[model samples]
Target: MTGKVLPLGLPLAIGFVAQLAISFTDAALVTRLGARELAGVTLALSVFSMTMLFGLGIVTAATPKLAAAHRSRDTGAVRTWYVQGAWLAVLVGLLGTAVLWQTRDILTLLGQSPSSARIAQRYNTGAAVGLPFFLLYVNARGLLTGVGRPKPVTWVMLAAVPVNLGLGCLLTFGAGPVPGLGVFGAGLASTLVRALVVVAVTAVLLGGGFRELALRGARLVPRPAMLLDLARVGVWIGARILLGEGFLPVLAFFVARFGADATTAHAIGLRLESLVVVFALGFSGAATTVAAWARADGDWRALRDLRSSLLLIGLVYSLGLSAVILASSGFTGRVVFGLHEPKAEGMLHKLVFLVVAYFVVDTLITMSMGYLVGLSDTRLPTLVVAAGYWVVGLGTGVLLSELTPLDFYGLWLGVITGGCVIAVFVFARTGQHIASLANSTTEEAPE
Candidate 1:
């Protein structure tokens, strides 16, 4: 199990971290501008993430499908899947870009301060410009993972990190020839990195074995039925992603009620906590890939082994991470954010613990969702996500923030509560599904 999963999991995790490194870079650089600019940048990033997620979910449906095709050695089908998903990615990216570019009026309507909204709009212009490229990159990434050839993604991301960081610093802070552009520059630099990554990976795909598929006429035409199938899956998955990720933006919206500094603090907390998220996602992706193969092979024993492996590994990893985050509270304050005041220091420490708790529950939720998604079971999970994130998480946060002593701390409590519900429901669903598979296999066995 380790041999099967580690190869896939490690690269996916590393690539995701590199992908998120841009966000950390933005937060750190923008902090120099003051809390207001930090708040604005954070808001812009959340909006961009939500917008990108729509495309991400849509394109992601292809992963398990492609994995199944690869497992069956259906080369033509694999090529067709990639081609159609590429078209869908372009369409989704274009529309998402247009929507995010127009977020100024939307932010104002959502009750954001005019100054913050303006800055967010300015930053989003650059982010919006690169949305299509990011979408294309996401599609390519899914293909690599689905085919169990994810090492290239790690290499590409490794190559891009320093490039991303260097450009971010240069454009953000201004070098000899360039004037500093602040939040907008941060956006521009990130977009540049996104564009470059797509180009790099595309070249690799075309130059490698995928080129044969490209030359085989699979890239030229669209299959309407499969395209619709992908979109159908994407819609539910997209909604799930929207609900899950939208929690932060929603929390940020409410946090603004506390003050700009509070909003900045929330944003910073989320950015730091993303360190946990990248690893959880790595395991989730591995689970999905492994589950895809199990379903394709109709191997219940492998499925059981995969689940057990995930549980043992996830438990140990989450505990170690929680301990590290708890111990690093002072380090995060002193080194990461440089919080000087006692009040600010205390607030960040409190938020870190809340984030740790949320990460633990979310780990189980993410792993369960990954396995289920591999089976193409997204609709029910969508409802679960909405209930957990919106109904449980948001509901708890609102109650605590408004009526109780927890204040904004109550918001993160909502996050944990919601995640717990999601974890239980998803794991139960997975158990039932696996049991059904086992029963059917038993019935089909020779007498």
Candidate 2:
């Protein structure tokens, strides 16, 4: 499992590191401006992440379907997945951009102050420009990833790191020949960097890479059946994202109620903690890639083994990172982030502790999602994710925060409790599923 998963995961994880560095750098750069500015940036980013869910869902739905087609040596089906997925991705991206443009109004409705809302609007507007392009990139990458050729995507991502960071710093702080544009500049820089990534990917798609996949024969129009097939699974995944990441704004709303300091601190805490979670996400992708291939190859035993191995790898990885966070977050809070204001560092420290549990469950949560997605089993996991993230997790947090003495701490406590619930339930669900598969095979065995 380690040998198989690490090669796939390592490149993606490295890509995530570059991606997280952009976030870290963005937060650090924005923080120098003001707490409110930091809060606004966080709000804008949360909106971006939320809006991209649909585009991401398209990729998820396309990946397994494409992989299955590839495995069976179904050239026509592969061409259909590739062609139809490209068109669908374009549609998802355009829609996503439109949705993101509404961020300011949403933020205002969520109770953010007028100044912060304006700042977020400015940032989001620039980010919106890149949405369609980013989704295009998603589809382009999906072509390769579905065929298990993901190392190139990692390389593309790593190359973008410097472009993203350098332009961000240049536009943000104003080097020679440029005016510092502050938070808005940071957003614009990201958009520009994403544009380059899109161009790079499109070049690959049309270049030798195209001939490699035999994409020359694929039509560039929507195939109704294929679109529906993709969307059947995609809608559920999007719902999961809408509910899971959608809770961010709700959580943000609660932090907003607390004050700017709390909101800013929470933003930092979330960004910092995301570093660890990204690794889990990377591993989840690996699991998905492996599972998709295994299923396509009719390797049920491999999937069963993968379940245990993914859990084992995820837990160990989660534990190691959690320990590092527990040990170093305080120093990182005060020194690395320079978050030494009253209650700022303390708030970050507490969030670090809270995220430990988040990561622990997240490792399994990510694995479960990957495991299920490969089986074309998204609907049940969608229910499970909704229960965990929205109902149990956020619901419990809101209850404790509102009604109990734990206050903010109560919210985190509830989140962890919910996480544990999710871990148990998802695993139980997977167990039943695997058992049924085993039983069916047993019954079908020759007498």
Candidate 3:
């Protein structure tokens, strides 16, 4: 039982590392281009992220369905779900691109400077062009993860990051005859690489990637019901994402009061947080895999084991990360934020403790929620995320900023406090569900 869960989970952990590597690569490369340039990339990435992640969540919701089909050994159903998911992704991608294309002005109104705004527009445009391909690739990963084939997704992700970084640098920094295109060039390169990854993953999957499973190719068509079901699940997840995103504006408002230095500090610290969050996300992805399989196989015992194992692992992992950040505060700040770079005043030690502290709580909560989703108990967690983030985090941050001397600390504390509350609530909820399941099973057995 333990082995089964671990094998499924390991790939998610590795895939997370792959994503971190990309961020690290981007930070390293973009640091050379100046603060404004770095900021441009940051804004560009955020806009692209907001658009892409919503679709990603929707596509991923199909995983459990695919897993259930595979467990029933229904090859036709699995194929139908997979195709339906891919087409849905493609459709969403196209629609998102059109919307973004029409709304570049609206994005600028979100507070990016003219230069950064232009870069964001270009990046968003390119990103939208790649969205269909990108989502198709992700759909393939969802299918693979459903059948316990996450290793391929992990490996492809690992390979893709280096490819993206190398190409991004070659284009942005200009190697040989290629003139440097700076941030915009990097965006273009990344978009192209992601498109290629999608194509490659699709080709491999279609060409007998999982021959043992006998996955069949089917005609691709829009299944309105499946699409609607995916959207139903997606809307909650999207709401969760939006609630989390809402904090950014509040944080931005708080940072603005501190002037540019504080704002830059906040942005840098947030990116640093992303590194830590990725690990929890890895565990979360594993939980999704485990939950999908557990439900498919109708093995509640396996589900319980997987959940317990993940929680234990996540606790230790998050604590260790927090300790590392505390211990190597200076080195980490220097390496990640270009500490030697001028104008980033009082960055080291000042924001380090706050960001790490926030990450510790945030990661735990994210992992717990991911596990809940795997159990097909998403509504409560989704509600918890929305309320905690908006009411507890954003509301407190805004009110305190107007009333106290806490400054950015108040904002960050709101995030940490909200996340901790949600974590505690969800942890308790998951425990009760498990206990109830155990009791029900015992009661059903012969005395």
Candidate 4:
């Protein structure tokens, strides 16, 4: 199990880490511009992250479907899933871009200050330009992963890291000929890098990187039935993501009401926390592939082993990450993010512990989502996540942050509580499904 899961999971993990490095690089650079600039870019990125991730969830539906098709050697089905997924990516990407282009108005209506709104709008305009290309890259990467060709996609993402760093620096601060565009330049650099990486991955796909799974002769036309099938699965996945992962951005809005210092601290903490979350996501993707293949083969025992292995791996990884974060919290505040303000640095240090706790619970929810996705079970999990995040998590956080003295700490505690609730429900569902599979296998065995 480790051999199969690690081989695939490691590259996906590394790729996710590299992908996150782009954002980390952007944040580090923007921090030098001062708190207001950081706050503004954070607001812009909050909207962009929510929209982009929802779209990513939609496109990610292709992975397990494609894995099943590949395992069965159904070339036509693979082509259909990939084509429809790409089309879905384009459509969703365009919608997200439009929403981001209106960031200023959106932020204003959300009650952010006018100055912050303006800066957010400027940053988002450039980020919006890359939405379609970024989504396309995600779709292509999903296709490759589903067909067990994730290494090429990983390489493309790894190579994009330095490019984004150099470009982001040049564009943000500017050289002799170019004027510093500030936050806007950071957004533009992200856009350009996304486009470049997508083109590279697409070239690999078309240039026989798929090996036995050729995409050359596939029809590019939009089939209503195929699109509808993808949507049926993808929409729930998107909602699940929006409700679960999207909770953070919404939480940011609430955090914003406390003032810029609070907002900046929260944003910084969330960014660091996401580094750990992405690692879980890498494992989740691998779980999806493995579970999908197991389901296609009707191998209940393999699925059971997957569950056990995932739990063990998730616990060990989360602990290791928590230790690293605890040790480096101070340095990260003083140096990495350059938070010279004593209040901000103090807030960040406190938040790091909560971030660690939150991610440990979050890892369970994430891994369960991946396993369930492989089983093609999304609707119930979506509802569960919605209730956990909005009714349980957000409601609790709001009450605590607004009404109690815990303030910022209360908000994080609320988030952790909600994550714990979500982890329980999803793991229960996973067990029920696995048990049913076991019972069915038993019934089918020779007596």
lDDT of each: 0.81, 0.76, 0.72, 0.86
Model 2 residue-pair collision total? 0
- How well is each residue in 81-147 modelled by candidate 1, as lDDT tens digits? 8888888888888899899988788889888999999999988987787888887887788778888
Shift in Å, residue 56, candidate 1: 0.9
TM-score of each: 0.89, 0.87, 0.87, 0.89
Top candidate when judged by lDDT against the true structure: 4
Ranking by lDDT: 4, 1, 2, 3
The segments of candidate 3 whose C-alpha lies over 4 angstroms from its true place after superposition are 20-37, 169-184, 245-249, 259-261, 340-351, 398-405, 435-447
Cα lDDT over the full model 4: 0.86
lDDT of 2 by residue, 405-427 (tens): 76676666766777788778878
Over 250-333, each residue of candidate 4 has an lDDT whose tens digit, in order, gives 688888887788888998888777767888888888888988988888788888888888888888899888998899899988
Clashing pairs in 4: none
Better of 1 and 2 by TM-score: 1
Model 4 Cα shift for residue 378 (angstroms): 1.5
Candidate 3 — what's its lDDT? Answer: 0.72
Model 4 TM-score on a 0 to 1 scale: 0.89
